[model samples]
Target: MKVAFTAPMKPLDHPVPSGDRTMGRLIVRALELAGHKVEVASTFRSWRAEGGEDVTREVKKLALTHAQEISEQWIERGDVPDVFLTYHLYHKAPDWIGPYLCAKFNIPYVVVEASRAPKRQSGNWALGFNAADAALAQADQVVALTNSDAQCLSQVLSKDVLTVLPPFLEEARFEISQSVTKGSADGTIRLLCAGMMRAGDKQFSYMVLAAALKQIADLPWRLTIAGDGPARAEIEPLFDRKRTEFIGLIPWQEMPRLYRSHEIFVWPAIREAFGFVFLEAQSCGLPVVGGRVFGVPDIVEEGTSGLLSDEGDASALAQNLMSLIKNPHKRENMAAAAVENIRKNHSLEAGARGLDKVLHAALERHQFKRKAHGGR
Candidate 1:
């Protein structure tokens, strides 16, 4: 099978990539691994801030122009891919030509990691949201990254069925050729947090963690935050007077190494579809401390891997942090368990196999639907 894939949220080359970009790349590789060819039809959107608010319009125009080119290619190319797979269509960046081109080419149209946030039902985001809804509804198969996302899609679209394929580990994360320990016996506890500081991000949560850890400022523990974002300026000050250190954005190549330097990984976000970083941390032999809600529970097993506190319960979060800090033996056991858990459940090869099953099912359904229509 040959597949044409796309995503409007961010390009594969975006500076600080998200889970969608990671998943998109993984799926393309997975299809290729399954003896299929994939051409990434995704293009445009550097997302640079050249002239403030005008940049949004520029990104949209570029996306639409690229979509037109892709449409033309689908028409002229003698052999269209056996399938058209789209990923991460948001209200901000809707897919305009996907449904039309895929339908015209008589190919299986499958969407992965698509969600409908109906809050943007009016005004500026409405058009893109509507486009996303239409494209998703027209798809022969829809894949939701988590059960929460599937519920959201069900609330808005009258789709036949949606499949759930959660975030899986990247290939690099599976190489446990060496052992990594959390921290030393001298009372120093190293906690790490790495992610974007976007609009709905947890830049403030890291800040709050820093504040709570202030009670143990005299202890040998350190707070090292990775990654930079627009909200960093606002939250950086909050970590200033404490033992927190901001290391800025590290290259993806260096993430596993950085993960090994820390004992406990902490980032309490409000809600996430599924945090790939949590798995990344676990893969690097670091147990996590995060919020109890959202799709996080799917990744973090309480007590074994790490602890999850109620959202906004700063007191409980601090307590959890102190628990690991106070008990080095527990931290060692948790670290070993985290790496073992990720290796067993979330390896890239395992993830690829899971997605292959979904993609093949969608392909079979497309063939079945085509045969039924032709018979009539």
Candidate 2:
């Protein structure tokens, strides 16, 4: 099968590293691993951070023009895709190209991680909301990355069209050769957190983490944060200068070693969409402690691979951390379980199999629809 992939929120090759970009690349890789030829359909990003009627109109116009040009090129080159797959579709970054291109070529249109927010229907993002809603309605298959997203999507689309595909990682990419033991010889528990230091949700998460660390000040632990962004000035002050080390922006290739060297992965993942960092950290045999919000629990199996505290509760987070810090045996056992859980559930092979099943069903559904509509 030939899949034309588009990520309207962030392109796969975008220089600015982020979870969205990583997930976009992973989706393409998963499709390829499923024995499908995948191509990035376009790099035209439709994301609008701020809402304005004029801005929304201009973006929609540009996206239509871009879609027309792409369709022309595909027709000329005889390279029309069998399936058009769009990732991370929402009001902020609605996909205008995939549906247009699929209609033009009579191919199956699928959306991965499609989120619908009803509150945006009558606000500054009204146009974007409408566009996204239309795209979801036209989609042959809507892949939700989390159950919460699936529930929201079900309100607009038929339940039969929506499927929940948990976030997955390429386990081989983060695998280390030698065995990594938790805790240092100095008897200090090394904690790791990798996330962009930005405002809004991230800043709030950092605040919670800092507060939790303060509660556990008596423990023998050190935190190493690996990320940099605009909110660094505001977020850095939240942590204790002596206990925290800020290592700005780790490269993708070095993340495995960073995870292995650390004993515990601690992050108050407030409102996170099943953090990829959790999967990456657990794959390297490190126990995790995160906030029980959104999809964090989906990745970090509570009591098995890691522990979760109530979202935004610093004291709860501190207790969870203290539990692991006070007991090395429990951490070691959870570390082993973390690695096994990732290999069995979140590996690339498992993700590829899931993609294969859904995409083939989409193709079959499109065929049936076309045949029922007089073979159009």
Candidate 3:
């Protein structure tokens, strides 16, 4: 399989530590692991955070430019892609290249994490929303990362087209080489949180975490935060300087060590699409504490691998943290379970196998459809 993979929300090589970028890289790697050749089709981003007339016009212009550039490259090389795969399609960032190029080449087209909502058709992001809808309708297979995403897309997608592929992490990168041991009785609980300090939901999550920590100020705990973004100045003030140490974006290679050293991973995963960081931490033998809403439940097994509190509830978040802090036995059990759960369900190998199945099915459908249309 020669797969032309793309992430229109943000390019795979975009110099940012975003979830979309991470997922794009993972998906490409997964396809390669499944014995397929993959190439980055384009790094042209079509993301518009605040969509209005100017943004809409810019997105439209970019779409045209992307189509032309990709088409010219295909003609020059004289090798059309066997399959076109896109990641993270939503109202704010819709794909316009994959559908066009796949149609032109008469190849299979698939979308990972494609979402649609009819209510968004009339709003500031009306143009983006409509464009996303158009792309979703054209996709031969739509891979949903969670049941919620599947349910929402089922209304617009056929039952056979909708499938669930949970958020995953590179298990090899985070595997513990030695026997797992519980945190020592040093009496100082160490909590770790890693994420880009961006605005919107990211900032809101940081704010909620800071409030939760404030509620448990008397607890003997230290926090290490690893990430940097545009909102660092604003986000830094939210945490108490004495208890929290901001590392300002550690390298990806160093993340496994960071998680291994920590006892608990805390992040108020507000509106997260099954945060990969949670899986990364778990894979490194660290339990998690996160919100109960959205995709967190899909990743973190409540009461086994970690604990979850109500979304945006500072008190409940603090309480959940306190439970883990006071109960070392429970924390130790959860830590072991965390690693096990990730190995069994959310490993990169698992994701690659699942993708391989989907790709085979999509190819068969594409062949059948083309034959039915007189091999056009």
Candidate 4:
């Protein structure tokens, strides 16, 4: 089967592999690994995606152009393929072209990792919201990343066919990079919280963690944050730059060595769809310390790879960090478990193969429906 893929946050040509791009790339890899061909049908490769007057106009224009280009590409290639698989087409920007082509061809339209924040009505968000809601309503199948996401998507699509698959990621990138300067385990602990500094992703709570940890000055620990976003300006001044290492936007391929050097991975997200970083950190043999936000409990095995604290509770997150900081034996045990969990559950081979199963299932379903309709 040839799968046409689309994503909202990922640029079709962006060289850097950030979270959304990585997911898009991994999903394409997964389809290919299953012996199926994939075509990235539609994409918006602009940094001006954030809400504004001009961005709204640009997104609409881009969506229209991309849709036409994809339709032409699929047509010129002789066949439209068996299915169309899209990822993360949310309110910021939806692959308006994908739905158009699918509707015209009367083919299966599949959406993965779609969500809606209905209240966002200003500027580009309104257009994104409208596009996403329409796609959710039109999709033949929706692959939800978590149970909660499935539930949320159901509210819009009113469909019960959403698959509740564990969020899959390529673990190879999280391997110990030789570039990261290794730190001696000389009584001091290292902690890291990685993710975009988007509001409500827990960058706000980092201020609280800083305040809490700064109180324990004699603890001999280093906390480094690796990410950048609009919220950085507001959040950066709050943390002590002298002690904390703020490495802005580290490449995805080199994050593993950074994880190996750290003792604990901290993510106190107020709300998270699924923190893929938890899997990355654990893949690099680092224990996690994260908030029990939406879908996070499903990702982090508490007391094994990491401890899941209550969402937004910086005090509790700080305490959990301290416990791991002092308990060397426990941290070491958890680190081993973290790596093993990745090997068993989140490896690239396993994830890509699982993806194969889903694509095959979708193709079979399409065939079955076709047979019932006399190959209509």
Compared with the true structure, all predictions reach lDDT values of 0.74, 0.90, 0.87, 0.73
lDDT of 4 at 259: 77
lDDT of 2 by residue, 1-376 (tens): 9999899998887899988888888888899998999988899899978977899999999999999999999989988889999999999999999999999899999999988889999879999999999999888899998888888888987866888888888988997677666557889999999889999998999999999999999999999999999999999999898989999998888889889989999989888888888999999998999988877887888999999988899999999999999999999999999999999888888888888888987898889999999999
When summed lDDT is taken over every stretch of 10 residues in candidate 1, the lowest stretch is 45-54
What's the C-alpha lDDT at position 376 in model 3? 89
Model 1 steric clash pairs = none
Q: After superposition, how far is residue 339 of candidate 1 from its true place, in Å?
A: 1.7
Top of the candidates by lDDT: 2
Candidate 4, residue 166: lDDT? 71
Per-residue CA lDDT of model 3 for 1-376, tens digit only, reads: 9999888888888987777788888888888899999989888788876888678878878887888899999999999888999888999888888888998888899998877767888978888888888888888788998888888899888988889988887888765466544344778989999888888888999999999999888988999999999999999999989888999989888778789888999999888877878888899888999988767899999999999998899899999999999898999999999989999999889899999988988888888888999988
TM, every model? 0.87, 0.97, 0.95, 0.85
lDDT of 3: 0.87
By TM-score rank, best first, the candidates go: 2, 3, 1, 4
**Candidate 4 C-alpha lDDT tens digits along 1-376:** 7787767667546765455666677777767777888877656542344776567667668777877877777688778867787787677766677687877776777877777676865554776677678887777667777777777776766444467667666665665435554345575678887877767646666766666676666787888899887798888887777778889898666677777777788877666677778878888778888888878777677888888788777778778888888888888899899888878876667767766666666566656767898987
TM-score of 2: 0.97
User: In terms of TM-score, how similar is model 4 to the real structure?
Assistant: 0.85
User: In model 3, which residue pairs have backbone atoms overlapping below 3 Å?
Assistant: none
Kindly report which residue stretches of model 2 are placed more than 4 angstroms away from their true locations once superposed: 178-181
Q: What shift in Å separates residue 126 of candidate 4 from its native position after superposition?
A: 5.8
Better of 2 and 3 by TM-score: 2
lDDT of 2 at 134: 92
